[model samples]
Target: MDGKRVLLVEDDSAQSSMLQLELKRRGFRVNAEKTVAAAAARIEKEIFDAVVTDLRLGSGDGLQVVVAVKASQPETGVIVITGHGSIDTAVAAMKAGAFDYLTKPVEPEVLALALRKTIEHRDLVGEVRRLRAEVKERRGVSGIVSASDAMGRVLALVAKVSSTDATVLVTGESGTGKELIARAIHENSPRRDGSFVAINCGALPEGLLESELFGHVKGSFTGADRNKRGLFEEASGGTIFLDEISETTPGLQVKLLRALQEGEIRRVGDNHPVKVSARVVAATNRDLMKQVTAGKFRDDLFYRLKVFPIEIPALRTRVDDVMPLAEAFIKKARVRTGSPATHFSPAAAKALRSYAWPGNVRELEHAVERALIMAGGPTVEARDLPPEIASSAPAKRRVKAKPPRKSRR
Candidate 1:
């Protein structure tokens, strides 16, 4: 806090001078005002790091000064001093947003300590603001590139559930943009100001997945070295997105159900349960109902997850969107590789539209990227596509042999 500015408001000239000298000695820029009116005027004209004021000015109380200082600059910290200290007066000063209260004949050390604490608090506040700004910049939505009805419907569901705290189950084939929709929901919800914690249920084994979601106490397992907070705890008051929920084992499903119902979770090897307020949004490609019938998933758990279900349509069903999706992917790939301008020829577009994309949007993206690298000119022709895609035409036209002729003979 060296070279920080401070405003001192005191009617006593000698005390004000001594405080100013001490603050200046500590490398602070000190400004001394003899009355509440002068302090208020000075504050209106300039911002200060901290303000120190006596309760009784020559003609007015410093409570008014506190109010004015806070009104003018809400970020500034205020400290109140009183010679005739009383419980009521101190309470009132604090209620008016005073950072600290000091009794008369205050020790310089105590005063210095309060000032140091206030400065540190201000620094923490600034850091939080900076972090929030960075998140906003990174996740800010301008224009998402989807024009297909499938993507449009997904976006609509996101908007609807973004305003509610209901658990959302997003179901789609792999690479159909499940994570993108999850982020959109988080950004539009009231929890947008908080963190969005995501975990893939299939990414880790059962034991690790449990610890990852619920955290664990020190030495909870063989490798546990310290107490670790789980994704649910870290996402408290925010959203936890569980991707590929179908991959979770039956045992873990029971534990997750309990946590969802009770709004609390127990860390592995820990007896104590920690309460959480995180909203859950789970996604999967497999049919939980089918899995439940096969005894791979719990029936009750499936119902709980489907409370606000949103099914994402496969890309093949949205034929009109193929051209747009391909164009977008080509642009993205080109920008990433610093390649020259590129476009698909009419024949190439026709082949893309006619073929069934078994791998969905992800496969189309890879095709476009590969074609961009293979095509020499600006236009990507049918020959530029992978052999699988180019051979789609022959497969579509195959005729059945004349089995009937043999029967007639």
Candidate 2:
């Protein structure tokens, strides 16, 4: 907040001098102007963190100054001051892009507080803009929808680690886009030109899982009639995403550990080992460390997969991402179903933001799709949402239930 440049536009010389002295004392660089034309010129020629102007100027109205400052630097905060303060004037000032309204003979402390708040708002707007730009840069490639600062940091980490061949372990609740992150890493890596094979370890039996991952020779098992390539082999020179890695049996864990340590795998029926250049990216919703301690998961395998761990935050933790994600999903739904729904109503958006999404991003995507289908108009209203979401009470509901009265004799 200190040393922030301010453009002061006031026609009253005495008032301008007093305000400038106070602001300078408070560590602001003040540039005083007496007319709207001078302030407009300063705004165009120089940059400022905030503009403090009187509603009434000598030559022209301060609204002109506000408009000029906003046109030049929309991020700059504008505070309007006036001797004849009224509701209409305040509303007009705000409509003209004033950040705040202050009456004449304002207290120094009040003015300072307003300035601080305005600066904070400007900073937040700037940060959101930066994050949006970053998200836009990797929009379709990352396939991630987020506005929260936490997810921004996660994306930053993804960018840093995607260039390397280091093994990555993504830990998050089910449906939190763990596989998407893995794909993002692969897409941005040197192996992006090659195949990106993914399989859910928990979705297959132990015996079949081994054959699916390590491959099997012809007639290796009862169902094996022909030679088959495993994910590791299919993904050779690329990346292999092993989702639900924690679900692998203990015996399979040893084989996985061997693959990670030695960069080799043995087919089920073959005696010779095959070298694989695939970069392994694993994910799990369970606590692998706890499984290691309980003897359910091999300790060595756990350590190998945990080399470069990335934990995704749950949807409840990144509530700021909810609306953007919902909007993105709505757009996707429109394309998939050829729906006419273009947006969510205010009530529907409120319901979305208020709900605690236990199923994370996957759940939100599905919900938006459902709402789009159920919507009658171009916008998705609260009634178009899922039953649980539509029926849930508002966040500000404070009416408590009355206690049940005993039946009178």
Candidate 3:
């Protein structure tokens, strides 16, 4: 508690002096005040670790100081001092935001212990809030590594729409970090404190996908032995990321559209609607407009999901991010793999920069991991890279001719 600041508010001059002396002996820096107005002004001017106020002041009650401290800095803990039979009033003060109460004819030792514990609790709460902020900075827009102007615009769009509840559609090639962008939006949103539920729509069959998304009631299906909540309910108060959303059948899209439009969902077995408040953030490598034109995806649902669209440029188009991204991946892997390699040699760096990463960011991460394993020393040589990435400039020209396409008609 050494050097911790405290606000001491008491009308009795003699008692205030004695208490201040004891607190100072215990290493506290006390700012003493005799009235509620003075203490309130002090609180507004400075932030203290804790405030100890007498319940009865000459001009005003201690509750006023408590309210002032809370309004100015909610994290500051408050301890109210009361006389013999003022227990009810002290309780009311606590309800008004005071942390703890002490009876009159205060014992210095007791007051010291209470202040210590209150300050410790306040510190713990402050630390938790700080960690939450770190999450937003680490996982939010600022954490994304990008050097290309196209990527900068994508991040700017993310920043603009993150604080709003608008539905987000992230269109990009596979392995282009669409999910990462979705997470950035969620972390920076007002719903950051809530759960982030993600499901790959194409990974599950239609029946199972429907059940998994909206949950299932017991006896709804052969394997559903018990009632289960769906992803929408689970993600209530937060954002849900739907990957490969274009893979959904038109039937499932109808349920999804209702959920998005009405803020409600129907479980697979139950007819009664269950309300859900999960924000939707959907991603697809396939173009949904084309899907709509081809009669594969619903146009109404497409428009709903496209309210705030963000398209991540392919890695081949943003070649400037390659080397920096490679170095970042290397640094991130060092702690886990304990790899001695810190960077690539001149030739290896050239290969990494020259190659067209059709697989985008995900592919680059894997390539860096591969190089670390293959390298014999602290510096990774060109031979340590994958065969395609290590090839000459002419070979890259052939590979970069066109992005590999998905197997579809």
Among these predictions, the greatest TM-score belongs to: 3
Candidate rank order under TM-score? 3, 1, 2
| Candidates 1 and 2, the one with greater TM-score | 1
Task: Please give the distance, in angstroms, between residue 249's alpha carbon in candidate 2 and its true position after superposition.
Answer: 0.7
lDDT of 1 by residue, 1-409 (tens): 6888888898898898888888888778889998877888999999998888889898799899889988999878888998787767778989999989999987767777788787778778999999978766556443345677777777778888999998999988887767777777788899986779999999999999999999999998899999999999899888999999999999999989987889889999999889988889999999888999999998888999899998878878888778888998888889887666478887788788877888888899899888888888788888888878865643332576653544310
Candidate 3 lDDT score at position 233: 97
lDDT tens per residue, model 3, 134-231: 87677877778988888989989998999999999999999999999999999989999898999999999999999989998999999899999999
Alpha carbon lDDT at 307, candidate 1: 93
Poorly placed runs, candidate 3 (over 4 Å) = 1-74, 88-97, 105-113, 156-167, 187-195, 223-226, 236-238, 260-264, 275-277, 287-309, 334-345, 369-387, 392-409
- Residue-by-residue lDDT tens digits, candidate 2, 1-409: 7899988999999888998999889988899999988888889999998989898887588889889988999999899997776768778889999999999788767887888889999999889989967764553354788699988988887888899999999999988889899989888888877888999999999999999999999988898998888999999999999999989998999999989999999999988899998999999999999998999999988888888999999988998999999988988889999889999888888888888888989998999999998988799999998989876536443674773464321
Candidate 3, residue 295: the lDDT equals 100
Error at 320, model 1, angstroms: 1.7
lDDT of 2 at 245: 94
Give the clashing residue pairs of candidate 3, or none: none
